[model samples]
Target: WFQQSESIIPNHLVSVPHPYVSIVKKCTPFPIEFVVRSYMTGSTSTSIWKNYQDGVRVYCGHTLPEGMKKNQKLASNIITPTTKEEDHDRPISAEDIIKEKWMTAEDWQV
Candidate 1:
């Protein structure tokens, strides 16, 4: 996979054992991982579908409309942010991050 990716874009591959490699240059760290989802699924109790079904109109930041069903596609893509953790990734919101000073307003806008 690393070799294939290198072929597509040069200068990123770094020498390492199979299943373990690094980028050539160091990179900036982001406070969050932005996830865009088009559909809702009730696979987990805390999933968007379950939350909506449980009368949670607002999630992350998207204001879901009424009459949505399980496995249904949303009106548009929704941005749900999460932060990487030791055990698992936890959901976060842009508003919370901004209010908590995790990210500046300008940085969040970007």
Candidate 2:
């Protein structure tokens, strides 16, 4: 999988210590994550399903339409942004990210 994805993304593979472990290069990580979903279902509290079931129409930044069922496929994919907290990640919007200076608008434009 790593070999196949090398062209798409840069990996931090340094050496394989064991079949289950590897030593990789250290790198600074971004403070946020973008979760793109084509379906409306998940098993976590921050999942779109949970939010929609709880009567939340807007999740992160996307507005979910009414009558969307669990596991139903969406017309298009949506990007749900979240903070990269160690203890627990939280849902966030793109505008909030920019406004809070977590990421610049120019960076987001990429």
Candidate 3:
């Protein structure tokens, strides 16, 4: 996978010693995580499904249309980002992320 995506993104994987153990480079990770969801289902409080069930239409950065079914495939995939700085991940919008200065505007572009 790294070999194929090496041109697009750099990887920190150093080597896979065995089936269960491996070595990796100690690279600093970004504080935000991008979650792609095709289905409206998850088990966490931060999940879209949970939020939707709780009557949240606007989540992260997307405005989900009404009448979506549980575990149903969405019309389009959604990118839900979360902040990893706290003990519990919090849903965040792209604009908020930039506005809050968690990441640079230019860095967000990448």
* Candidate 3 global Cα RMSD: 3.0
Candidate 3, residue 106: lDDT? 89
**Candidate 1 lDDT by residue in tens digits, 11-104:** 4456755455555656556667787889987556447877787898888877888888888888888888876656776567889878877678
Residues 6-107, candidate 3: write the lDDT tens digits: 678777877777867768888867799899989999979899999999999999989999999899998898899999965799999999999998888987
The window of 10 residues in a row where model 3 has the poorest summed lDDT is 1-10
Cα lDDT for residue 75, model 2? 86
Clashes of 3: 0
Ranking by TM-score: 3, 2, 1
TM-score of each: 0.63, 0.73, 0.79
In candidate 2, what are the lDDT values of residues 16-75, reduced to their tens digit?
778898888897666998899999999788888998999999899889899999999988
Q: All candidates' lDDT scores?
A: 0.74, 0.87, 0.88
Clashing pairs in 2: none
Stretches of candidate 3 off by over 4 Å are: 10-27
RMSD of each predicted structure: 5.0, 3.5, 3.0
**Judged by lDDT against the true structure, how good is candidate 3?**
0.88
